[model samples]
Target: MRLEAVGRRYGARGPWVLRGVDLDVPGGQVLRVEGANGSGKSTVLRILAGIDRPTTGRVSGRPRTAYVPERFPPALPFDAHGYLVHLGRVHGLGGRTAARRAERWLECFGIAGYARTPLAQLSKGTCQKVAVAQALVAEPELLVLDEAWTGLDEDARAVLDDAVRARSAAGGTVVFVDHDPRRLAADTTAAHRVQDARLVPVPPDAAGGPRVVIEATGGGVPPAGLAYEPAAPGTLQVTVPAAESDAVLRRLLAAAPPWHIRSVRPAQPPTEPA
Candidate 1:
């Protein structure tokens, strides 16, 4: 998708939150947006997801998009499962398929037990899972996440990280904004910051690269062509390349005794000399 000279404001005389922004969102890549609070980052994401329209400029080649906003309304009438199923149908899935996918995602996020719980009664973390699950149920071509990980626990955060990787590996585009500086650092294909009501490209070194430390207990020699460092007794940290990460994961999972695949994340970039 492409945005050309895009600008947005609330009213005819309202102050512009975003102006003259030009961006290209290529398929099969992850993009990160950075900015301080109230800096128009959310506005840019809303425009990209078609949740809001630009007051001026043009957007072209938009694909099937799904978005998870920062603040989810937990007061909705339906239960977690019901809401997800409803959204899946809205995304064009059949009733049975939608229910099935909803269940799968709820299970993936470790909230299946609360599937029937009312949205208003669920915890913040669980509600966040529901929000994320609704978006993934459709397997959209473009996924926009604004602070999607804010209320999630450690395991849920890891699940989200894997989901983001899985989406990009399947030739989808994922755009996100989060406060954490290290979020998906190694995996981001491009990074941009909102500045002066405009989008600015961030240098690669500054943005960092995706680096994951995979630890395993029962393992033979680390996979060839991948770098590994000893982390603790009977464990090794293997840094897998971002693009081929999914393949590496599959290999680890399929290995004899499964290599006890531990964690995957962005690698920290090296510091420059003073």
Candidate 2:
């Protein structure tokens, strides 16, 4: 998808939040947006996710999108599972499929026990889990997250990290903004910062590069020509190249017994030679 010379403002005479922004969100990549608080990072995400329209310029190639806003409305009149199921149906799933997927995701986020609990009564962390789950119910082609991890617990945070990786690996585009500088540090294929009411590219060295650490067990040698290190007794830290990661994953999954993938995450960029 592409946003060309896009600009946004609240009212006809209001101040512009974003102006003259040109961005291309390509498939199979992760992009990070950064800016100081009150900057237009959230505005950019909203525009990208189609929640808002630009006052000027044009956006093209819109795909099936799912978004998680920074603020979730937990006072809605639905239970945890019911909300997810409703959202799944809105995303085009059948009733049974939606309910099944809703239950599965609740389990994945460790919130299945609260499936029948009303949304207004859930804790903040649990509500955030529901928010994240709602976004993933449809396996969308474009996933947008604006500080979606703020209230999540450690395990839930890790689950979100894995979901981000899985979406990009499946040839989808993922765009996100997180306050933490190290969030997906090395897995970002592109980085941009909202500056002076515009989007500015951040160089790879400054913003980190597209590198991921794949942790798996079951004792298998690293694929030939792949760079890796031993992360633990039974784990391998396979450093995937930015462009060939999908191919590498395919090979791993095709291996005998399919080396159980424990986790996938951004690998810290290699230190530069002085």
How much does candidate 2 score in TM-score? 0.79
State the displacement of the C-alpha of residue 255, model 1, in Å, after optimal TM-score superposition.
Answer: 9.2
lDDT (Cα) of model 1: 0.86
TM per candidate comes to 0.78, 0.79
Q: In model 1, what lDDT does residue 191 have?
A: 88
Q: What is each predicted model's overall lDDT from 0 to 1?
A: 0.86, 0.86
Clash pairs detected, candidate 2: none
How big is the positional error of residue 49 in model 2, measured in Å on the Cα after superposition? 0.7
Backbone N/Cα/C clashes per model = 9, 0
Instruction: Give the per-residue Cα lDDT of candidate 1 at 160.
Output: 86
What TM-score number comes out for model 1? 0.78
Q: Report the CA-based lDDT of candidate 2 relative to the real structure.
A: 0.86
